[model samples]
Target: MKIGLVLPVVVQHPSTRAEWERTAGIAEVAQIAAAADRLGYHHVAASEHVAVPREIAVERGGTYWDPLSTLGFLAARTRRIRLATQVLVLGYHHPLEIAKRYGTLDQVSGGRIVLGLGVGSLREEFDLLGAPFEDRGARADDAIRALRASLSDPAPSYDGPFYSYDGFVVEPHAAQVRVPLWMGGRTRRSLRRATEFGDGWVPFGLNVDELQAMLGTVDLPDGFELVLGSGRRLDPLGDPDATLRAVTRVREAGATVLGVSLVSTGAGHYCDQLHALRELTGQAGCTFDADPGHDRDD
Candidate 1:
């Protein structure tokens, strides 16, 4: 199975003061990402949020780095690792706008882009952005269609309930002919949307049993990817044996990519965890490769 990383600095919910201080800046983020790339990790991902409401800022911690900008910056720094938006809130931006930004990112990154999309659940944030909270699901569905159309062709066009454009072309089409669209959420609607439209599915908070049960209900295509996020931190400082077993089980349960959060007090600690992770996976006979036989660029 391929291992993907959610960089510590981008989210910033540091457990200790040392951890907080370690993951504090863009330079730190670059250093960590460069380490992941050099260590042979499959991908490095970042989260997104335009703005956080004051009432929920404390709970949310309000340190969300914009995914596009963060990934774009990392793209220039890393050579081989794939750049991903762990879950870009699709409801907040127009489809063409997303296409222009991320498509350009894909081109610059040398075809290493995985767009993880979601129907955002923050009602207040939606309100702040002037997006209709109630209709987010529908909007997300339409947005995915629009994104696929625009990203696939140089002169692209789409007609949908939420967005429409014709006789217009987006320049610098993505390096990959078809950029992978991974839908994220745990609801049945989310699963259906993924099966219907997305190239992959990224479900958060689902254990092995839960994922098996969900997979039993859907007819996953041969090349469709199932990426599961580890609900808890996969800390290398913890038990390496247990971590290996858990990773093995998840791989057996049919996850092509496992998203792991590396908790570190600093960049040095982060690199240590990554090296440990690589060793653990290597010992378990899991190999790393940019392509896993899935047609993500179809």
Candidate 2:
């Protein structure tokens, strides 16, 4: 299974934050990504939130680095490591705008981009942005379809409930013919949406049994990826044996790629944890070698 890393600077939750993360910024993030690249990690991920309410921010840490901007910056700093948005809230922007931004990202990143999208859950943020919070699921569905149309063709066009355009050309098409679209969330609706419209399903907080049950309901094809993450806190400076066991269990449960978050450790220890993870996974010699062209049509 491939291993992916989630940069610690994007979100500052207690479980994932180290002491130094409080003051960490772009340089720290770049250092982490560069180390991951050197360590043979398949991808490095970041999260997104345009704006958060004070209450939610207090709980979830309001310092979310914009995924596109962060990833774009990291793209210049590293090679080979794929860049991903853990879950870009789709309801916040038009599909055409998303297609344009991410398509450019793909171009600059040399075809290494995974557009992980979600039907946003923050009601206040949606209200603040003037986007429909209640019907976001329906809107996300339309947005995905519209994005596929806009991202794939030079003269892309789409007529959907949320967006409509015809014969308009979106230039600098994504480096990959079809940028992988991974859906994030664990609900039945999310599973259905992923099966119908996504190239992969990225679920968090689901145990092995729950993951198995969820997989049974979806008709995931051979190339359809299941990207799993350790549900509990990952203490990279702690036990390597325990981390390996957890990773092994998820791999056995049918994960194609595993996301490792070195959140509890400072940026200085990222390389150490990455090396330990590589050795634990027995993939020390592995490379970021997935065929970008292999799964072009989702």
Candidate 3:
């Protein structure tokens, strides 16, 4: 099984200016990209959301940089870490645009890119963007399908309720024409859509029971995935045997990748995660060649 990191990038304010430093600052961000590459982590997943959720009002997401720009900078900084997206809501961007942006990042990063695509659930987000919420799911399908075709040479055309294009060309093409698209979410609605179209599934919040029920209901093929994470923190496993057993259960359910988002707020939180990372790696049989360190170094 492979492991990935979901770096902290949210709207909430950190308590101090130091903790408040944006993750995308050029020098600081480079350290993280390089660290992931050097440590042999498989992917550094990115996320996208435009509107900030506030009480009674929706607005353009503050504390944001364009994900494509940020990922591009990281691509330049790293040689090996795969740049995977956790979920890029499809209704917000066109297929051709995504193919252009990510394909460029893939070429720059030596083809280390995985596309995590999702039809978003937030109705407020759609309303703020002037998109009809009801049509967004179908729109997402159209965009992803079109993106798959456009990524290939002798590019394809698409016509749907949401969009239409004739003879689109995707440049800086990826090693794989269709980037491995991990579908987001695990609800039954999400599963049905994923089985029909996605390369894999990356999900959250479902418990062991919920996972089993979904498995019994869905006709999953080999290589189909259930990317798992939990609310619990991982402390370095003094007992590797028990750790392996827990991971194996998820693996038995067809998960090809398992990761944990070590929640953090300030510098103290970052310190706490170093131990968590060590524990997780040991359980997964991953080794960090160097002694674990608190700060990312340039």
* RMSD vs true structure, all candidates: 4.6, 5.0, 4.7
Name the runs in model 3 displaced over 4 angstroms: 9-26, 56-65, 233-254, 263-280, 283-298
State every prediction's TM-score relative to the real structure.
0.92, 0.92, 0.79
- Tens digits of per-residue lDDT for model 3, 79-159: 777788878888878788888778877777777888888888888888898866897777777787787767654465777
Which structure is stronger by TM-score: 1 or 3? 1
TM-score of 2: 0.92
- Per-model clash counts, in order, read 0, 0, 1
Hey, what RMSD does candidate 1 come out at? 4.6
Q: Model 2, which residues run further than 4 Å from truth?
A: 235-237, 263-265, 283-298
Most lDDT-accurate candidate: 1
Query: Model 1, 1-298: lDDT tens per residue?
Result: 7888988777755342244654379888888788788777888888888887776766666778888889989999988899988799998889888888888999999999999999988888888889889988998999999998898577888999989999987887788988998999987788889999998899987766777788889898778988876666777667786777778877888888888876566777777788788878877766665334321211
Q: Clash pairs of candidate 3? A: 236-279
- What C-alpha lDDT values do all the predictions have? 0.82, 0.81, 0.66
lDDT of 1 at 58: 69
* Candidate structures ordered by lDDT, highest first: 1, 2, 3
